[model samples]
Target: MRGGFCSGGLLLLLLIAPAGAAGTERADRLAFEVPPGMAPAAVAGDETFQGGFTCRSDAGENSAGTTACRSWISPVLPLFVFRLAWHVDSVTAERVVTGIWIGRDGASEPLQEMSGLELRMAVPIENAGFELIDMDFDGHLDMRIVAGGTAGPNVLYRNWLWSVDEERFVDSAALDEIVSPEFDPETREIVSRWRSSAAEGGVDVYAWNDGVPVIVHREVDRFDGPARCIRTFYDRIDEELRETGTGSCG
Candidate 1:
């Protein structure tokens, strides 16, 4: 989900408003999923989330090693869907996907396809994969792709919000590595934690305002020694940073 793996699979719905539009149109959708695949039937996982599609796939797995792939489609403005068929090599873990044209009713064509390489998937379909969600309690859904660290500690991801005014997905700034990013529906906050060290870390609570994620609360805990440490609290809502206690055993 982060970038380059299996080459496909994720869903996102967007509602954009064009110039001089009365209010807003219906929400368009882009669905991607790794459908069930078999070993000997085909060269790639050429499956679709939508029923009855004329999609084409030129992806090959004739090279050395095993290959994995997934199917994906994105919604276009007027009346069309963009589909991609991808594959990956088993040994090298190289991945590739081809773009195919799809119609409204799920009919697709392989006209002037496009391809790329760089994918790695050894196990079965991951349950904790990418997803399309309305992070800010908005009606429109946004795209979220998760990328884990192979060796490093930082986790990276690509987030694109639905721009109703622009009629497309607006890419958000890259998010740095954090412990947990949990969103509370009742509080309407995204709870995140950043660890400075083994015993030192901070928690950042943020809220989404008009599609913008902003910090509203922060708590930093550091250990000066074993039983002598301090926990600093920061109320970002009022821009207040205070040390309520000192010389605490935590």
Candidate 2:
């Protein structure tokens, strides 16, 4: 059988955004040892680092986006923490975030100084954070950050897949474009749902090919009339999404 719809694609964003922001706030206040032996110290040059820390760009000042926030990623091997630094664009005045440092416990310096960062603007800044998940189901955690403003229900993410052999994170533009993405380990597929309007939306199923996501199937639903809705199905053939059939809206 093919993959089915997630309970609610957009719901995940609404639930996760606030939780992550709150968790960061709590971690910033509390002083606790993470990964057991790591001595508490200031991270990213913030002086008050007790355990977990959050650094913010001064709201009153017009300096570049120089705020850095630290959060410990859960359930990662060779446990480490990542710091996301925000810089304000001089002309646009938008706050942009990029991965700056990745450090393990007991390390004097960071394990890696992240590079090739795709700058993404986080409007509210508070909702700006990072999540570590295995994007390709390769048993390695990858980084995904809130890429843009969340005024709309459809939230977008900037993705970085972890490369085990290379010992670094590689950015995936294809994965970043998938909205409200969900991974199915059983089928080894990625599912994305999009809403164009209240009456128009669609679902896209993607398969990984050579470390990139390619659309394999698509389902579109839209209202035809006052009370009528139509569902269209498309299959990817020869690298194109071709309409194959139609049916009543499910």
Candidate 3:
């Protein structure tokens, strides 16, 4: 999901902007550790870390995005924490969270860190955050790193699926856009809801097909003139879909 949808798609901003401002909040910036033992290995390929840690995304990315309030503990990797910064420049040099770090544990030394990073967006400073969850249901943990804003052509997406066999984090190509993606175990599917346009957008449910996420169902809503409409689509599934919606903006 990280590479497909989150990679600079021309999406429309929703009426209600996502909370957490445009950039990382200075007050909530978490301190990183490079203890006596755990030294950060410079990630290769990831140009964002060329000069240590950079917020620069792809070349043509929008530089006016914000990184707001998103730092938190990994849902599965309780030992680590992460946060987003719209612009890496929005914070002081010490507080800028350029990459994942060994968090608040009192471990006298560093635990582990990625050896290299390969950012795809214009700059990590645009708008981005991280979500740690088990996208592969391996009981370990998976990570989705998003750069750029929530929408438009400046968003960035990256996923690291835990490989139990190799005991390492590897790039995931079977995702949509990890912009806070939702998963359902019962159906074994991943779902996403986003603003596609000023008056249109929809919900998508994807299932793993040949290791990649395939859209299995979709429910789209559109507002034109003085009217509002909705449409639904089902993919290669054999189940009755019952949808129920509530409320409306005044």
Candidate 4:
């Protein structure tokens, strides 16, 4: 499952061990990298191998609109990263928003949205057990945009988190009003907790367990609609990591 949010202005603070710290006990720090030849997937018919459909790009009046494409690769062991681009009529080209989900192979069912806005952004996917202590302790991550465009000053977006066991999304959560959230991996009983709000200004916290997110600690945040919190947990059934083929982004 995935945790945390990624945006242009959010400050991501990862806990790291001091210069010469020892093994395991030493604090684990967050790291990211982009491997060579990593590029967006090629558009085929109506689908892109990276899990994008109805993908199209527009370059205004300058050029013919092209297809939006994406590619995913694991730059680090167990951490998958992706890069995406939309070729709208050749001249009008842009990258997909940076936090959208592209594909999850044998991991979990893809998080689907009703809006046509593609869930093809790139974000870090780490194994559960990491904790993000808010530096401000406001119990939430800093303000950031997860997806969607802005209307004047306020932006519209959707935030999602899932707990996966094997290849199923056992639990999930989507928010239209939440700005940011932190994941606490250190908590033994409760693996992670998400703090969010409603359009009417109601705030709530949804909690879940580590390995068995869907089975245990199934709770929802009651604000307006059906409790909108989805949770899923992962177990270390397969410890070995495998790499997948690279996509050509022409």
Query: RMSDs, each prediction?
Result: 14.3, 11.0, 14.5, 21.5
Q: TM-score-based ranking, best first? A: 2, 1, 3, 4
**lDDT winner, 1 or 3:** 3
Task: State each model's CA lDDT, in order.
Answer: 0.39, 0.59, 0.42, 0.25
lDDT tens readout by residue for model 4, 15-93: 1123455322322211123345543343344221221112222222332112222223111112221212221222223
- Per-candidate TM-scores read 0.49, 0.66, 0.48, 0.25
Two-way TM-score contest, 3 vs 4, winner: 3
Best by lDDT: 2
Q: Which window of ten consecutive residues has the lowest lDDT sum in model 2? A: 8-17
Order of quality (lDDT): 2, 3, 1, 4
Candidate topping TM-score: 2
What does candidate 2's lDDT look like per residue over 13-101, in tens digits?
A: 11112456764563344223444444333334322222333334323234433333344332344556455555567777666664456
Model 4: lDDT equals 0.25
Candidate 1 residue pairs that clash: 2-146, 10-32, 17-164, 54-108, 66-90, 95-118, 95-119
Candidate 2: segments with Cα more than 4 A from true spot = 1-32, 35-76, 87-95, 115-127, 149-152
Q: Write the per-residue lDDT of candidate 1 for residues 12-83, one digit (tens) a residue.
A: 101112434321221122333324441112113321122112222222235322111222222222223434
Q: For candidate 4, what is the TM-score?
A: 0.25
Q: After superposition, how far is residue 50 of candidate 3 from its true place, in Å?
A: 35
How do the residues 221-247 of candidate 3 rate in per-residue lDDT, one tens digit apiece?
566556654444434445444443332
